[model samples]
Target chain A: MVSDLSVLLTDRQGQPYSLTSERIKHLEYLCESTRRDIVDTLYKIGRGHAGPSLSMVELLISLYFEELRFDPSDPKWPDRDRFILSKGHGSLGYYAVLAQRGLIEKRELDTFESLGSRLQGHVDSNWLPWVELTTGSLGQGLSYAVGVAIAAKRQAKDLRAYCLLGDGECQEGNVWEAAMSAAKYRLDNLLAIVDWNNLQGGVTLEVMPSLEPFALKWQAFGWHTIEINGHDLQAVLQAYHQARQTKEKPTVIIARNIKGKGVSYMENKVEWHGGTVTKELHQIALEEINARLSELSQYADEKYGRNHG
Target chain B: MANWKKAPIREALGKTLVELGDRYPQVLVVNADLRNSVKSIYFMEKYPDRTIEVGIAEQNMIGVAAGLASLGFIPFAVTFARFASKRAADQISMSVDYCRNNVKIIGAYAGIFTGAQGVSQQMIDDTAAMRAMPNMTVIDTADVHEVRSALLFAAEFSGPVYIRIGRDEWPVVFDETYTFELGKGRWLREGSDVVLLNSGILLPYAVEAAELLESEGISAGVVNMPSIKPIDAALINDISRNVGAIVTLEAHNVQGGFGSAVAEVTAANYPVPIEMIGLRNEYSESAPNDALLEKHHLNPPWIAAAAKRALDRKNRLRC
Candidate 1:
């Protein structure tokens, strides 16, 4: 079933852009493999961060594979684009992407949360590559991203910064501060994506809802707004393509997602937000994820030919 | 050996920043609607492109400063001490200090010396809070000379720095030729009977206390320990050895300001008979500037009296 998943995509010209789709499929595979890697590592060490990782799988794939201009080989490449995981709890997605991209050794993924692993429960730039800022406290990453964006603009550098925020985390006052500043400066080179997975820890996003016409808020704040289905790889790629044409205002891709999209029992369940994967539950999750992988691969084959062909 | 003259440190800081702006284009200043109050008006006027006025938003101002710092720019974030310390503390902790950003925080109207504005506006504990943070350089310039030197030093130094400047007209204590070194204490009036350790605007009162002690035949040594975080422990140890007892003075809360730092060091390393002369845990209710200092027992006479009391206590304990 895992073997059936294929990578395929389309470009801006509306032509059959197979490389984009293929890379995205690889990204999703990276997410699944790394998801298991993170869960197993977390289980061995402790518990607290799987649901957030699961929700941001497709979003991370689209950014890493389609949008960002980063060299995994040279993480500190000066001219390289910056990516900030504002919702740091979803760092497992980032770690998996980094590992698959060859930024870090695949073996290093197993050591996550160990006595001295660089893969902390939260993202720390001190340990990882391409992580622009060390974020865990929430609401501060957007501000940091704004700073990086402003610097890039002031220097007239071609480099851009992309920051990913969790919908639950956007309620922080500092996020608005950053949003206001990003618009005021006309930071077109900056892009902010919200992982609008409708669940927070131990409660639904509806309970503590920051969801009244959310995309309009960014539009009102002078940002180029783009809302899409987060789980749809094609939609995610399309949003990124459109954001590039944005001239004066910063772009916000508010990707609506589920807490646990693929796994059956975990879907939209707040309990999965930060829970440990028990061996029994882990097996069930693997089976469910395997089924989804096959479904994705079938969709890819119907849309585009096989990778070799 | 040190220059002892009258220069307001706040003015020197402004001058030094203006010069720095000329030298480095990346030197940016973000004012929290306190451009004139903190004397950053010069930087704003001189380099309009580099200066940002965040309009009374201390939290956003600090957040912006931290962001700018992360992007390899030297951002001097300025605001009145009260707002910078009390209001924008979270941003300081998360964005600037925790992230180890090269951001400098210039605090004006620090302490009760903000004249008749009362305790509501006057920040007396900004230095102490800044000092408590990791990798933070907390400085209180003695005079205009030291302020100039401190600005240059902060520019060269990496990581976070907090400079507390007085709002009222403060008498210049350091001379034009005075040298300011990072983490080093300056010994002004050296004596053996008692040691008066102080920093910021209170250093002037400490000098006056030394003169009064001399008139009474009490050899009081006055040390200007401005950099509060990486405290002058060597000087503290030397004072404990040379002077019989020690008296710490500052126009701040006795609870955690300069005096509290000195007490913590001296008590742990060498238990000396120490007297702390500062505000008596009471908020100011808009009194005349000088009257408030006298009322809080932070004036020269009060400091001198405290020194003598400490000396007597040391002698009594020795007996």
Candidate 2:
């Protein structure tokens, strides 16, 4: 129960680089299943975010399954690492991770976007305080994370704050304001991840006022930047590790990913940011994700044993 | 007129914070680098670790406050009224109000008394803007003592609260015994002809106007309204029905501020003749506080004059 982040990260539960082949396979399985779950859930709901939700599946899976500390039994665990989805529009992905980790009841997933549902379209903190901050508007969650990190540091608490923002959200001036504060305070326990799919509102960021030299932007703001392929589980885990090792400054991981990573027709499609998933499109998506799942299943059987989840 | 006590309302916050930090360690102040002007430096001097100065970034200051609030800390996000209500309005609206976070938004230099920082700095619409927000408890305490009382009350309040304080020292209306509560108005005077509905630093002006009206044979009552959002609708309805006429005063725009709030309540519950004395629908120029007050017609003379007008309307309507 010591309030030390180094102790939190390097504990016997498992360190960053210690990812075994079986653990990687398990994470991959979680990723495919999460994608299938998102597509299934969005299909039933008939209209929910698909593109932005589809892009960051691995990014969220690694953090919940392999990174970040928390007890699902106690959402208010004082020592738990905090997570905020700054790109709250892409909430289906975050919800999948929460369900996969058993942080939320799996049956509750179907009630998303329904009247009085706990799982709001954009993340809500009302019923689920573990969500930390209710953020549908972009560019606000980073500053909130900065506040949480400052509070944790001030109290010498081991709780680390993590905020995931969209690449488009970086255009907001509020993000940089928070960045300056985090750097000025040299908050090493704070980590900001930009899901750098370079696509927002159905247009490539290059077409819009682009985020060219994005990593250098964080560096100029005095952050330790880690650029990586977001879908790669090992890279995502290592990025989390590198962020932990950096001292005297905050870290930003520019996770390069596709707008729609798993689905064929939806892959990199600009319209899919919140594009509706039709019955035909849903079937294709599940088929594609299941194909990946079966391959990971065979590998798990070879390395370890038959897996149930 | 005997010279009344005058003290800076802005000083009470910092002084109280110093003590508040000692008592409630979870209480923190998020600053936008106007610590000296807003007198938050007093708290910083005592508890440096408790102050999170965001250095001139209002949006980040609010967002940081929301974050701290999410972590169950009482964060008073302090900045100029323009920055708190206008510049970062969305941040406050979405992050603080919509999220219903337990954060105190402190808008300093809230009126024409911005020490000649002028047009850009003088924020007259803060009361209007903040009061328009849902789930936000808007309070503009009248004096230094009431400001301290409100701050102490805010520590106990759970939802988002917007507290507006003027910059320079002005006339103090209430004594140290005046306690603050949400959605309540205290009657400063009781008159049958007309009522002066006032909020914020203009309380003394309304009081003075009531006294002046008494000198003239016009019986003008004064009611100090510290809470604006959960406004004193019951008191306002009582005045409108029984007192017959109302003259509303604030150091803000007359459109959607304290005056309009009264008008809205009376229009629905008990309709009456309401005269508003504050900034007309226009921007104010940079000038000395007194000059700005004089130019905006928010001084005691203008308030007394407005009350007379309301009395005239009341008598005419009766006939």
Candidate 3:
């Protein structure tokens, strides 16, 4: 495997147009299946978090396929790239991607929100592989990631540390404290991706402008800032690649994405933040996701036929 | 003991890390701006590469310690007990304890030893908060000897360990040869009239109290209950049966310090009129260490008074 997975996202013609169609298909599946799994699991659980998890599906996909360097067989690989999900409410997206990458058993998806399952509603590092820090309490993950990044630099190791943040969670003062430390240490190997889905709980970002001028704020705090379409897999991959090339300052990729991207009824809806999908809603979500899966598969088939034929 | 010979617990902790750093390169120290006060300056001066000062940011210091621990480093986060407990408890709980990270948190300036820093800098109930966490091992060493032993023990012990240390240079009650275990309580003295269970700087006074009690025809057992969370139930049970009464003391709030931990064991297994002698749910203003203890009814005279009260209660029960 390439040290940087972004190298794998070649174009449809195998020329690497920012991102390949194969990788794009993977991103879409990650987003769809995450929503599907969360809905089904929640349906079984009788309670599930839908909004925040759906919001970060694309980021998780781009991370798993385009950035992080790790072995699924040996999850405890010391030299592996570390990923810290600071906005841990989006854990469903992480669980789906981990399962898809074979880091965890696919059946583990069913265990989510269940009593005995290692897959919990909140990410637990001890119980789950690839989770570097245990987080559900907001504002803590970034600081931990900064710690990891600083350690990597001290040891002269090339290991990169990535932290995913929620837009609403930025209201916490501790995030800025972590930002200052990361910048002070000049941890260029660290990358913080904020899922700017605009809503937190029952309120939208407009309802509470916690971090306006967010990009400039990071830049002021001594970070190289980049803004991109979070749902655009190609942009995410390209930005991640650029982030790796940069040095001396940490990178903050401000990704603007919808809370619910794949499911039409759920898109941008605040009610779906942690609302349970009833048996009836589960059917609708499942059907909608299946439709997207078929559409992407058909697109892949058409592109293959045109080129090969 | 000579004045210069009396060592602060923080000195022992810092000194232990240097010895450990020689053996294990991964043993790191994270200190706040109080390195000199916390005695971590010794480690910083000796092993500059191993020690890091996170400035005045307590929360950041904890987060950085957790991060270092995650990368297979044994980080001893050194800071004042007040800031370590209140200012950065969330990071300690989430990044450290919740993840079961191998970080030894050495809290300096615990109890009224803060002296003139007042109640703001003193940590009266830090052990209680740390004990509340499932995976955290809370240790309150009675003196410099116990501190040195506990710091070494924590290195071998897995998971998180929080050791509360006093700021003042305390007299060495135990010798360097004394073996310090993590959860086991040390039997300091044996008595039959009443059991004086105490820890931290209060042990010396408890020993004195036992001596005074002996002169008054009351044998007082002095048990140094350092490991508060894992209360030595068997030891406490033995004290309850052999001694007529039990008086728990500390330089802490009686609600959740050594008294509370002993009370939990005694309540279920052995019920007795346990007199909790410590700070009575109040903060102390800037004053001398002895004066602070005297005001909180934790000094030798106050401990003697509480012991007498317990003895009187014991005699009434016998009648």
**Chain A TM-score values, per prediction:** 0.86, 0.91, 0.88
RMSD for each of the candidates = 3.9, 4.0, 4.2
Interface Cα RMSD for all candidates?
Answer: 1.9, 1.2, 1.2
Clashing pairs in 3: A11-A16
TM-score of each: 0.92, 0.94, 0.92
Would you list the clashing residue pairs of candidate 2?
none
- Report the Cα lDDT for residue A286, model 3: 86
lDDT-wise, the better of 1 and 2 is 2
The model with the greater DockQ, 1 or 2, is 2
Among all candidates shown, the one with the greatest TM-score: 2
For candidate 3, what is the lDDT? 0.79
Q: Give the alpha carbon lDDT tens digit for every residue of A1-309 in model 2.
A: 112222223421333334455666777887888888888888888767888888899889878766678876798887889998999988787888788877877678899888998888889887566687888788899999999899888778887899999999999989999999999989999999999887889787878776788888899999999999999877887788778888999999999999888888888888888857778877888889888999887543323311223
Docking class of 3: medium
The candidate that wins on lDDT is 2
Q: lDDT tens string, model 3, A1-309?
A: 112234443422234443346646656765566567766766776766677877788788677755677776788898888899988878777887787656787777877867877787888887777788888889888887887887887888879999999998889878888888888788888999999998889777788855888899999999999999998877887778778867889999999989877777778988878877767777888898888877766433323211212
Q: Candidate 2, residues B1-319: lDDT per residue as tens digits?
A: 5377778667776787777787788899888998888888988888788889999899999989887886778998877888878888989898889889899988888877878876888888988888889899999877788888888888888999998888777777767787898899989889999999988888887888888888998889988888998998898988988988999888888998999999999999988888998889988988887787788888788888998888898899999
Instruction: Name the weakest run of 10 consecutive residues (lDDT summed) in model 3 chain B.
Output: B1-10
